[model samples]
Target: MAKRDWNRRTCAKRGHTTYAPSEPELRERLHVATAAGEAWRCLRCGDFALGAPHGGGPAAEAPPVLRGKALRDLFVLRLLAVERGLRGVLGVLAAWAVWKFSNSQDALHQLFDQDLTVFKPVADHFHWDLEHASVVDTIRKTFDYKHSTLVYVAGGVLAYSLIEAVEGVGLWLGRRWAEYLAVVATAAFLPLEGYELHEHASAVKIATTVVNVLAVLWILLSKRLFGLRGGVEAFEAERHSASLLEVEQAARAVPAADQAAV
Candidate 1:
């Protein structure tokens, strides 16, 4: 029989008081222990404890809060959201520019009369439309000597497209710099989009404008984008749960090894 002193030492290490069980009580406890048992070792504290028969208190320390990776991932998501919103703004701008230019007889005429044969199918394709004829005629009469306007619009589009390209690539690389750049660029165009909707008042225009506005709000407020969701402690708790599962699996494997030994 194990000495009462040894039992007391074991119980003390486990943060419990020891009491000798009667024969019947010992059998009952042993049966319960075998059903729901856990074995643990605490080195510095010199403790070796087994789980209670049915359940137990906390087994490990609480995990630390999320810090580094949490912040970085939030930044990445924020940038990605900003990039999306910016691209949406750019799209609206491109569409508006096309709409305004088409309405201008001078612009349409200039574009229509250009050597579109160079672009093959594109020039010939839209030319067949009756509206295209009106556009061509309008441009010829309105902008007779202002070919410079066409040059300006083309240059502006090229520059804008280049900016979009840079933002998109940076976002793909998960850079926070790209996110800030995207917010600045897209915000700059909000007034333009608003003015366009006010002037045109079409369903299509209104929908496009609303979409960009909401996109901006979503990026700014989403927990994942803002880095306001789970903290470091949450991440550590998950890791700890995984560790417990691994330990339980290892314990089960032990009996299999003993059987193989026999």
Candidate 2:
């Protein structure tokens, strides 16, 4: 069975990137004289694309076109960005809820009391001790918080939401600073997440923790963050080498690659 080419597959969906190489040797490898004027090899999919090159420049100035593993890494980053955006939106909603609750705590408590009264008969039938229920006790504790305290809580949540939203946008745009920001921000709150899990274990919390851990680990290693795996230098070098143009450039050293292209 043949292995799949993710880069080519992605290019097929998104369209190919072609370049006109002004250098004689570079153009010889990339351009083929077709009856339809000319065909230049796609820098991404590596297929002969019949169209005017969108841009032309010296070989050294050719745009960096990502392929293979580099494209996969980009997909992962965008996916992670989506997750961050969802979490950010949720956080904002929660903050707004807390803010509203703080403003109308007394009215909300009255409504809660009425709801509880309505459910009294059902609770008795089920032999549920509503008065001493842990969940009810926890809910009641919210009423004891001062308005200022609630406002502060809401502010904190809103701030966290903003951070996540910014990180999401940055990662989606493939900004280098965003990668560092994501690592620092997510890792900073890990201790709190662990503590929350320790206080009350739940499948959702466990899953969230696992996802966050895996994200942090994957970003650090795959992106070579914090000097791991030769750091930014190695990461850049690897990305550069993945380009079809770079592959062809490397071929100049080995004559066999030219024949192989034929």
Top TM-score model: 2
Tens digits of lDDT, candidate 2, 1-262: 9987887888779888889888788888998888888888999888988878878888889888878998888889999999999999999999999999999999999998899889989999999999789988988999889999999999999999999999999999888889999999999999999999999899999999999999999999999999999999999999888878788878865776667888
Name the runs in model 1 displaced over 4 angstroms: 1-138, 141-145, 223-262
Q: Using lDDT as the measure, which candidate wins?
A: 2
lDDT of each: 0.51, 0.91
In candidate 1, what are the lDDT values of residues 1-262, reduced to their tens digit? 7533432343345453211223342223222333346433322122334653223223232221122333344445546556564765675577566546545756555566565445556656767654346765664564554445645665677577667777777665555466566666777888998888778688887877677576556444432233434533554444344342234445656877999999
C-alpha TM-score for every candidate: 0.38, 0.93
Q: Give the clash total for candidate 1.
A: 8
Give candidate 1's whole-model lDDT.
0.51
TM-score of 1: 0.38
